[model samples]
Target: MERSSAHRTPGDPVAGMALPVYIVCGGTGGHLAPGIATAQRLIRAGISVELVVSEKEVDSRLLESYPDLNYRRVKGAPFRLSPKGLFLFVLHNTRSFISGFQYLRKNPPAMILAFGGFISVSYVIAAWLLKVPIVLHEANRVVGRSIRFLSGMADTVFLPDGVSLAGIEARRIRRLGMPLREEVKHVSKETIRREMDIPHHAKVLVVVGGSQGAKALNDWVEETHKSLASDGIWIILVTGPGKNQMPELKVLQSDMGVDVEIRTFAFHRSLHELFSCADVVLSRAGAGTVAELVCCLAPSILVPFPYAADDHQLANAQDLERRGGCIVIDQKNSSNLYREVLDLIFNDWLLGRMRQNLRRLNHGDAAENLTKQLIESYYPGHLRATAVENSTEAKEAVNG
Candidate 1:
């Protein structure tokens, strides 16, 4: 079925094109990581992928390693508390929506995957106006305001199992587990430790402060450094950018008499590697962090950020804790973190049980499952051969 260039549309960058999936995910690693993982899976199944992302510093740094995918930026701003800030935010959002509409009109994809951010809201609206089929994913147990508003227009809303959004008008809802990088499943612990210069014998407690730095979490760790050191735990603290004083922390580590290795980084692109080297993760319960901890089978002490939208981080932590995978410490009562750490370290059986529970929460094939669903439900006739091949590959993966 050879086609001439004359039939090629201006909207498409490539000629003689089949339908590509357009993914709108940006701002933070939580949205971007899953989007990239899913895009990688789709590409492997011979599907084209184009991403619409924000040019936020974190987004740019994260996307640098993924050069094969096609991505463009749409300017975005968060809603502000002040009236003047609100006006500017609205103005920026309006321009973003217009930009998204123009891009979609030019390079219309087969469908859109909205990964729940304010930036994604604009693109989702543009896709709706263009009559493009859309699948929305809300990573948290409690839906984000943007995704809740756009749910009515989404063809399908994908959520984690047992999560429910009350009074959503989506055409259909499905439980498609969180998508994660392939490296999370395959990276060796020894290799990760060697790369980080952490000793294999040292019990590692990796502190992740999410994509944006958590000042409270960092302060807590610094305050409790001596206690943590007394327990013979080496800490790999990933201190995200903004108000970072890693040099001071290093100096403090050198002064301490306790035998604890406290290595700090502003940010590390390879977080999966850090997770692999961890015996216990002391982290803020972002949805992405929870998914990764579960995927890596790491025991954790989750402290949900109180100010997160709708207190969704708390819900995320609660869900994992309910399954006996981790202990949740309320940020307001964060003094409990030290006690929880002692309990985890002393109770060998507890740590192992939690790790076992965490392992049960892993969904390594989430991206593949989502890809299969999209092919079967929306474009059944379009990629029959590729779909069959993917099906066989999935079976072989499970059997092997």
Candidate 2:
């Protein structure tokens, strides 16, 4: 396969060619967030990126904040065995595959970086057929079905530390952590709390249910907020889109006549603020959410979405738990959630320890490292050689 013009230097003959890296990451925030993060890094390095996303509303909503990103929405459906489900899956995927193939044939990319999802299946196959190098990043502890299916065809598969896929060649796999967004870094707790008008001394509990709100977690907050508020815990609840109609802020009085505060939102664009301000977080254990928690050093009580495919959320939470970054509570035993939250929140020692562990787990350079690897894979030793040459030229020019 011919090398794409994307990696060429500006003075190269074909440098102005329009070939861009195509990132297939859609369906959920988990997939799309990392894709956007990596895309941002690539764009800063002078590599153009076009995101390939699904036709899901969530994808559109997520991309709304990223109007500058070039993206295409492809129709896709998850695989299902039922007759009707199977028919829709085949029909949608066939259309996606045809569209993807035609596009790639016309404007071949330097490479296709796919964050595993049903949306990626057709694109990966199309890229493979066109001999485009493919790279897969699996953020979860257990590999997803899409990555598992597409792994063999990929030039490289990036997995979290200590995680591996069964069938892929060991040489093809690399240990890299999740790529977090630029906005995911931590801010001072006091700074954010003051900005949000939260009390300085308030014990804050933040509940996040992922892109689509967790009804169980939402209900738990609804049932227990009053009691929690009575104990002087301020609540920041993200109820997902359209799941609740509560006003953004509410003030209540406890039996002891102490004023209590609760803030609720359908979705929050500034998650770093909430996570940084949180004393303890109650959240579903999606890999992206776990990575954000680690980035913010927010000690959390993770409730894995029991219905997650292949129980991947459980696996993700377990890995974090083993690393001492979090406490995992099975959704089935959520009755223990209130007690766990109370226990963790009041125990300053445990929370501090968990925060310390999370700091150790934070792979702050994951995006930069992944971007370097992706470029290196396409043009072996080219980046390093260019950097050395540039450095030498710069020094010579200065000395001369």
Candidate 3:
């Protein structure tokens, strides 16, 4: 359960009491949501918060809801596809990292928390050099290149349940559960279904391509949808707006089996309604999205983005399957042919078992778990007393 952030105000003793600040580095909602949840927890505990983000949507649009937050647009996230691309990505990332180091000279945090993305790499590096406590989080089963590159730099690295950190030092790692939306944790299913306009009599299937839409996934849904729609199944497909919305989809809607509906826009922060109305979810295996599924106890058919970094998404799905909360479908396999997913959705037993298993994987308090750890790490008497003290002095140096 999450404590509300509304308690923080300017003059009230309960809200105005001076508390040491914490810095979070992330931009994308995948990373930012966990950071935001953690920050809210710290704030309610009477700590101040600062967010250092890349100059991207991950920060501005996602973190816009919190006005008291101190925001800084750092470097852009990196994308590397080839040898030359990798070199340039590293060079730019290093420059961003140096900038993060300089920021520490003025406004050092008690400790730094990261959701493991390009934007966080610099923050971790800067924290390490300044000898401030640093914690890094990986929301997936398989750690990505960013986490791998900087894991050694952080004082501790936390993961969502079920990940295997094979080569990393055991002393530095711990398995914390996934952070979930506070709203989703307390949401009323009855109200959510009403908001989504989902019918009560129908078993709902939600197909999500991602924030930018997956053409291949949408194409597959288009091919087998009519038959499922003809049955009693409600097929709600989210094509992810902007680029994926098809003018031709009107024809698909026109030729409807009467049970299919499609949508294109949804707030990234408040996606609980879609999950609430869904009996089954079909989506790519991004760590953040899969964590939301487990948090909601929503069983899903996982299709890893075939081209995701290091093929990490596929590995994330495999871990969920090992935990029995999901079924993995590799896009490369012919067995994953178009109708296969629709068939799985129709398999009442398969869907029921996955939903039942998902309950076991629910960490409903991942944010709480991590926030508690942050409090321990940042407290003056904790194991990281030196880091906390040094960080305080660094910030004082900046304030002076």
Candidate 4:
């Protein structure tokens, strides 16, 4: 891959003098978003970064917003034991390993910062072989397969509080929160409401089904939207790509003598706005989504994706619920979803408390703190001092 000057800021200390940090974050939005968030922080600190992502369409779509980010696409496939699954996994991973090795041999990175994903596996191994420092961040409470397999090779492993890997040394582990995109901020609800054309009096419910979308959640909305509409609720459903054949906005007169509006979209880019304006959100409890909800102070009813590896989503939801940030409903018991949403939406006191808890749970500077640690630990002498000073100033700015 050709080196691009686009990622370097005006005063980048090591703009053309040193190799850039390689961030292996792709496959799903959960992994990629946090990677981008950290990359942005590093760039602002005058550290160059190149993102390595999978060839998935979702990855491509999300990268559209970041036209200037230096990134490369690599083939990746999930690990499975079944015959065809294993065959494809080996085939794709081998290609990715070769691709990563060729590039890194020519232009070795200062370090490899990887968010757990299948796409990270190949590159992590290549970095390990090249003796490049590897830093792995696991957002979920239950560690992922990639992180678990690669943890021993990593110089440092970042994980959520109270979660631990059996054999990894305590010295190599750090308790760190998930990194959030800069766009995921707490904006004024009234301002967002006006921009989205939602009425001030409307009780807004936003449904998000992870990155590729949730079919079960979409079907639930389709089945019970009229009931919700009758209660004068405004619904914004993100149906995922190609999942919703008809995406339109509809305004209906509710039986309760109120105007109910429903908007359906295949995808929505401005999630921070959606979460900020929402009175309640129905979402899958992916670590990245949960982190965004906390940042936006959006109270939510979470349904963990039943098929998630090691049932990690359930672990994430449970942790949030333990902290009073959100409510968790098992997918098998989804028949209770409508009732739960209605009960929670109109409960102002409960919602307020949840928001407060979410605010307390919010670690707004995860990306900054993580970047600072990486700079202090892995960056070269002259560049490390400059980057550390810049990161400290940025942190002070945020706090000030």
Q: Supply the TM-score for candidate 4.
A: 0.92
In TM-score terms, candidate 3 sits at: 0.80
> Model 2, 170-228: lDDT tens per residue?
88899998898777789988899899888888789999999777888889988999889
Give candidate 4 misplaced runs (Cα > 4 Å).
1-17, 380-400
Q: Please give, for residues 251-350, the per-residue lDDT of candidate 3 as tens digits.
A: 2232334545554443344555677677778888887788778777787888899988778888888888888888788777734654665677667798
Model 4 Cα lDDT, one tens digit per residue, 1-400: 1112343232344423376889999999999999999999999877889999999988998999999899999998999899999999999999999989889878878788999899898998887876666889999989999999999888789999899897888998999999987777888899999888888888999998988899999999989898999988999998888788444888877887888888998877778789999999999999998888998999999999999999999999999999998999999999999999999999999999999999888765899889888876665464647778889999999999
Clashes of each: 2, 0, 2, 0
Q: State model 3's lDDT.
A: 0.67
Ranking by TM-score: 2, 4, 1, 3
Ranking of models by lDDT: 4, 2, 1, 3
Winning model by lDDT? 4
Question: TM per model?
Answer: 0.87, 0.92, 0.80, 0.92
Where is model 2 more than 4 Å wrong at Cα? 1-18, 379-400
The C-alpha RMSD in Å for every predicted model, in order, reads 6.2, 3.7, 9.4, 6.0
- Candidate 1 regions exceeding 4 Å error are 1-17, 168-171, 186-191, 248-259, 387-400
> Which 10 consecutive positions of candidate 3 have the poorest summed lDDT?
1-10
Off by over 4 Å in 3: 1-23, 79-91, 161-169, 186-189, 222-228, 247-259, 266-268, 334-338, 380-400
Question: All candidates' lDDT scores?
Answer: 0.80, 0.87, 0.67, 0.88
Task: Check candidate 4 and list the clashing pairs.
Answer: none
> Is candidate 1 or 2 superior in TM-score?
2
